[model samples]
Target: MDILDILLSASFWAAAIRIASPLIFATLGELICERAGVLNLGIEGIMVAGAFSGWIAVWAGLPLWGGVAVAMLTGMAFGLLHATLSVPFGLSQHVVGIGLTLLATSLTFYTYRVVLPEVSSPPKIEAFQPYEIPLLADLPLIGPALFSQTPLTYAAFLLAAICAYTLYRTPVGLAVRAAGENPSAVAAQGLSVTAIRMGAVITGSGFMAVGGAFLTLSAFDSFFFDMVNGRGWICIALVVFGAWRPGKAVLGAILFAAFDALQIRLQQTAIGALVPYQLFLMLPYILSILALVVMSRRAEVPAALMVPFNKGER
Candidate 1:
């Protein structure tokens, strides 16, 4: 089919939503971190650790949700390490984040080898099944695309809504935003900027881990090395694309996912025969870069983002 036909196809949209699910989770997690003035670059390794932890937990016979919990807790542990050095100790956020990534990635690989030393291939497990909401799934184009997705996909969207509400509508949300924008003001009001930043990093990291779990427990049945494949980095950019707002970040994720879905479909059409496969592979990133450039031009970053705050210091 042609490009226009492919764009209109319900199946294509469904694929886009599925592809966007993991991104939605990670982007929201990153958004939360940045909103609280911390840049957790450990996201990539955190996602890798999360994917492995969740899969291994399930392989060890925990229920699917239990595996998800394991993954989230694993991520939070790494996040705590990140927070301890960067928040209270006032270390370089960049160095701490990168160090955490390397540490998490290496630990995950070591654990995998130790657990399955003799196994040549990764094992598979039963994964989550799609759940279709009755009436909503019956709709024409929007139904299958939105309503017919795995439980994790639905949870991703729900979490986005919750993030938006918490960030804009609640007192705690105000404190979090204040911590990122003007820590002095937060301190004047008797809130602990260090505590707020640390909590945000830990909570955000948990969400990021759940994103990784989505891959093993929902998108696929088995885990493999490099399965996360830099999606974590993409999530960082998506936060910028969405200007750190949960709602906008979600849209950015969906837009990127659509471009990705389109590229895959185009590779199957007559155009795939005319162009190199590498070009198709690059299509999503190229388009996403252009979109990011346009959208980020007007994005207003939090004033205190990445600025280390020490109590009683201006």
Candidate 2:
């Protein structure tokens, strides 16, 4: 089919939504961290660890949801380390985040070797299947594209909505945002800046891990090396593209997913015969970079982002 026909197809949209699911989770996690004025660059490694943790847990006989919980806990453990170094200690966030990424990634790889030294290929598990919402799945293009997704996809959307509401409509959210925008104000109000920032990082990292878990538990049945494939970094950019708002960030994820889905389809079309395959691979990232540039030009960053706060000193 041609590009137009492909774009109009229900299956194409369904694929787009499916592809966007993991990104939505990770982007939201990154958004939460940035909103709290911390940048958790460890997301890439955390995702890798999460993917393995969840899959291994399932392989070891945990229920599907149990695997998810294990992944979140694993991510939170890393988040705790990130927070300990960057928040109260007031170290260089960039350095700490990158270091955490290396540590987590290496540790995960070592554990994988230790657990299955003789295995040539990663083992497979029963991944999540698509769950079609009754009447909603019966509708036109929108139905299958939006309603017929794995449970994790639904959770991603739900989490986005909850994040938006919490950031804009709740008192606790106010404190979190205040901690990012003005830590002194948060401290003045008797809320601990260190506590708020550390909490945000820890919680956000859990969500990031769940994002990784989605890859293993929903998108694919088996885990392998480089499965995450820099999606973590993409989610970071998506957070900036969405201006750190959950709803907008979700839209950004879908947009990128659409680009990705389009490129895959394009590679199978008549035009695919004449072009280099690498171009097809680059299409989504090129489009995303252009979009990011346009969106970020107008995006407002949190005033206190990446700025360490030492209580009683300022």
lDDT of each: 0.93, 0.93
Write the residue-wise lDDT of candidate 1 on 153-183 in tens digits. 9999999999999999998889999999999
How do all models score by TM-score? 0.98, 0.98
Q: Which lDDT tens digits does candidate 2 get at residues 22-91?
A: 9998898888889999999999999999999999999889999999999999999999999999999989
Question: Cα lDDT for residue 70, model 2?
Answer: 100
Off by over 4 Å in 2: none
The positional error of residue 32 in candidate 2, measured at the CA in angstroms, is: 0.5
Q: Please give the TM-score that candidate 2 achieves against the real structure.
A: 0.98
